[model samples]
Every structure is written in C-alpha cells, then in structure tokens.
Target: MKILLVDDEESLLRTVQLGWPEPDDEIVTARSFEEAKRSLLPGRAGDFDCIILDLQLPDASGTTILSEVRKRTDTPVIMLSAWGDTQFRADTLMSGADDYIMKPVGIRELHARTLKAALLHRKRSSPKPSVIAIGNCEFHVQAQLLKGETHTTKLTGAEASLLEELALANGEPVLRTDLYLKVFQREAQFGDKSLETYVSRLRRLLNEHTEDGAAAIRTIRGVGYRLVA
Candidate 1:
C-alpha cells in the first residue's frame, strides 16, 4: 500500500520512515501544506491508499488538507496531533478523517490503525466506472480501448489514465501539473515533454475514431488541456 505522511517535523518523518513495520509499503513525506498540496493534486489523490496528516502544520491546519483530500478521493485519512482536546478530535472526524491518533503514538499501533482504516475505506467505497463515452467513441477504461463505428485502438496505461482524468472533468480544464502527476505518478521536472507526446497521440486517435469536431482535446495555453466534445 502507498501512504502519504504530511508533517513538518523532520524527526517524526525520519522515525516513521525508519520504523515502518511493512517494509514493502511505500511512504511519501511532505513537510508543509504547499508540499502536501502538490502531492494531493486533483487527479493524483487516488494514487495513495491512505494519508497520515499532522493536525497542525507550519503553514495551515490539518483540517484544511483534509477538506482537499475529501474533495478528490475517499482514501482513508488518519489525523495525528499533539493536542488531545476532545473538540479538536471531534472536528477532524466531522471533517471526513477516518481515524485520529494522538502524537507520540507507538509504531505498532500506528501501523495497525493505518491498515484498519484503509481496509474499512476499501470495503465502503464504490468502484469507478469501467467504460466512458467520449463523443462518438467509447472508451473502455479498464481495457484501455477506444472503440468507434469502424475501428478500435488500444491505448497505453498512461494514455488511458490521462483520458480518464479528462473525461472525469467533463470538459473543464485539467491542470498540466495535475495531469503529469496523475499519469506519470511523479512530480514533473523542468522541460518534461512526455505529457505533450501523449496528448498528441490521443488527438490522433480521437480524430480518427470520432467525427471531425465531435471530440477534441484543446490546449489551454500556459494552463492545461480540456476535452471538448
């Protein structure tokens, strides 16, 4: 399982990374609200199985991050705080946090709670749609297929995920940074053109499968791309 740990304390981040019981589980750390926002970009939130957030941060409150997380994905969130105030705990829970753990929590207990919260979330969450209709063509999300009246094209996993994000937006612009992170599963470096290459390929497929102006991806200069259908 992939987990995101958001906290400003270098010591706590180091301790969690070093003492994490499941060696195979991947853990990503963010030191501030800005860093956490980048990691939790709109289309990228589903990449993590769970998020462990510090209730207090230097830049913003943990509940602020929790609100953003709830807007994107239903992934489990466990709030960690030094404060033991009942009202604080109740507020976090009311704001969609799946669990709350007081600071100075033992590694074993933290591990157990993390697993339990994630498991419960999975059982309660609904599955995403397997197929999406894009203008005159049909996209089989799981199969990575684009089907039209006379032809069908297969797409790479990255292409399919990129398309899925755009489709989910329902024609609204999707940020370039958000697309790059969601499709590539990492932060984009300067001058990365991989996303552009995928966009060009998808445009070609769309033109060939759909009517001339039925479906298209428009570039929002200096911003991102939007699907117009």
Candidate 2:
C-alpha cells in the first residue's frame, strides 16, 4: 500500500515512516498543507491507498487539506489530532474523513486502522453490477446516476456507496453496524445519524423514480436494512 503522511511534527513523521508495519508498503511524507497538495497533484492523488493527515498544519487547517483531498479523490483519509474534543471528531467525521484518531497514537494501532480504512474503501469501490434495475428506474453504479421514466438524479459518494452495499446484498438484510464500518470506515456511534440520512435520501430517490411501491428499502428493525426490488 502507498500511504501519505502529512504532519508538521517532524519527529512523529519520522517515527511513522520507520515504524510502518508493512515492510513492502511505501510511505510519503509532507510537512505542510502546501507540500501535501504538491504531492497530490492532478495525476498523482490516485496513487495513494490511504492518507494520514494531521489535524493541525503549519499553513492551513486540516479541514482545508481534507476538503482538497475530497475534491481530488475518495482516498481513505484518517485524521490525526492532539485535540480530544468530541466536536472536533464529529466535525471531521461529518466532513468525509474515514477515521479520526487522537494524537500520541501507537504505530501498531494506527497501522491497523489505516489498513482497515483502505480495505473498506477498496471494497466500496470494487466492481459490481454497473446498472441495477429498481422498478422503472435504473441505477448506474459506476456512473453514480439514477434514471427514471421521467427524470434523473445524481448520487453523492456516500449515497452511492450505501446503495452499492445494499445492491451487493441482494435481498438479504445487512447489519447496521456492518454497514457503518464498511460504508463510513468506522464503528457506529451514539447520535450519529449519517447512515440514516443516506438511507432516507435513497428512499426519497427511489420514491421519486419508481412506481408507487414498486421498490422499497425496508428497515429490519434490530438488524439493518434491505432492498426490495
């Protein structure tokens, strides 16, 4: 795996580079947001399997760098911060970060989380049915588009990822926790309604594009959700 490490702390960067668990993995380091942007140039952002970004940078806030990364690619980003505030963690998670870790982290734990995030990203992005039919609507997974008999709708990355999981499950019920981990790359937390929000969005889209009751997303109560085609 190719990983990008962005932090102004020279010592932490050096430690991560040397202590990376996988001997075959390549590590790229950038000390500031500008340097990170240079490394993520137009043709190069997709080269990274995962990014370990510092919450505090010398020139720009980590959120700024995160926005830049999201604009370029959906590469898994794990934010590292010394700040332990709950709001900071929530804000980053809501802003598309795959994972957030408190600073003074152990190399082994970091490596594990990093690998999990990358793996989940790969799984979400893996090839599936390019187009799925739901009633009169056709969901183009690769294109992130939904075409109905009358109108079309585009899906956000998170929405598309959620749909992919349900499509892959066919008619079977997928666990909520499993979806949270696979889709969000983190465990579900109390009061975190992101999954519900995506599901609601999909429900609305399905309702808009399909005949009444032609297709539906069923909540499995204690389990999770399933798609009824």
Candidate 3:
C-alpha cells in the first residue's frame, strides 16, 4: 500500500518512514502543499491508499484543500494538527476530514487510524469524472493525459495536477501558496523545491509540442505563475 505523508518537518518525516514497521507499505513524504497536491490528484487518488495531512501548513488553512479533494476523489485523509481542542475536532470532522489526530500523537494510533480510514474510503467511495480544458489542450484528470492541437503526452500525476490548476486559472497568475496547496495539497514553505521542479517538467512536457509554446507558462516576478491564453 502507498501512503502520502504531508508535513514540513524533515525529522518527523524521517521518523515516520523509519518507524513504520510495515514491511509491505510505501510511505511518500511531502514537505509542503504542492507536494501533497501532486500525490493526491484526482486520477492518482488511488495511488495512495491513505493520506496523513498536517493542519498547520504555511499556505492553506481550515479545510479548503480537504473540500477540494472531496470534490475529485474519495481517498481517505487523516488530518494532523497541533491544536487538540474539541472545537477544532468538531470543525474538521464536519468539514469532511475522515479523521483528526492531535500532535505528539502515538505512532501506533496514527497507523491504526490511517488503516481504518483507508479501508472505509475504499469501501464507500465511487468513481468520479475529472477533466479540464486549457486553451487548445484537453486534460484528463484521472488519466494524467494532456492532448494539444499538434501533440499529446502523458503527464505524471503531479504534473497533471499542477497543469489542471493552472488551466483552471484561465490566464491569470495563481498565488504560489494557492497553487502549492491546491496542487501539492500542503503549505508553501521555505526550502521546498518540489514546486519548481514540477513546473520545469510541466513546461518541458507541455510546451515542447507547439511553436513558441514555451511562452505559455510565464514567470510572474516575485509572485507565482500565469498561464498564457
């Protein structure tokens, strides 16, 4: 089974991976929002049997990303937060989080909850359609496909998620925080290079097919990026 772990602390991530005694499971770590989004995109929802989300992200707040995920996929998500108040718990659960875990939590409990949520989601969820059109390109949400007028290419799950967000923005520049949270599904934090790497790969895959297509993804100085119409 594949597990997506979203957190910013490198040590915690290392601890989770090394501490997990499960011999047959894969634990992938995402240090920020963008990284999570890549792992949790619609078509790739089944890529991870379970998701462990951190609540105190630098970019996103409340259950915005959680709501977004519910719209596209039914993958089980367990939200982890430092705040352990009853109010917070009520808010998150009502907002659609499958489960809420407090910080300084026991690894054993976390694992148990993750397993339970995964099982429940798999049994209860059904398939949903996911597709988007960006200018001349058509994006298949679940298939990670991008078809353009003259060329077509298969995108990685992360690439497809990022492209979908950009396409939905419709030529406007999207905030780095929003893109990171929306695509990676975590906060945009310092020293996280995943977003840049994905964008470069996206530009290469998406622009190489057409004349001057490289200009389509424009850098917005100190902001984020804007997709050309």
- For all candidates in order, the CA lDDT equals 0.84, 0.87, 0.75
* Candidate with the larger lDDT of 1 and 3: 1
Listed per model in order, the count of residue pairs whose N, CA or C atoms clash below 3 Å is 0, 0, 10
* Per-residue lDDT over 148-215 for candidate 3, one digit per residue giving the tens place of the 0 to 100 score: 88777888777877876676565778778657766776656679988889888877766665555567
TM-score (C-alpha, index-matched) for candidate 3:
0.52
Tens digit per residue, CA lDDT, model 2, 1-229: 9999999999998999888889999999999988998878887898999999998898998899999999999999999998857766766787889889998899999999999878767876787678998878888989999899888999998888888788777777878976886689766888999899889989888889987532478899999999876
- How well does model 1 score by local distance difference test? 0.84
- lDDT tens string, model 1, 59-149? 9989888998999999999999988676666556766887789989998898898987676567546466788777788899889999999
Which model is ahead, 2 or 3, in terms of TM-score?
A: 2
What's the alpha carbon RMSD for model 3? 16.3
Best-matching candidate per lDDT: 2
What value of lDDT does candidate 2 attain over all alpha carbons?
0.87
All candidates' TM-scores?
A: 0.54, 0.63, 0.52
Best TM-score among the predictions, by candidate number = 2
Q: Cα-based RMSD of the predictions, in order?
A: 15.4, 6.8, 16.3
Clashing pairs in 1: none
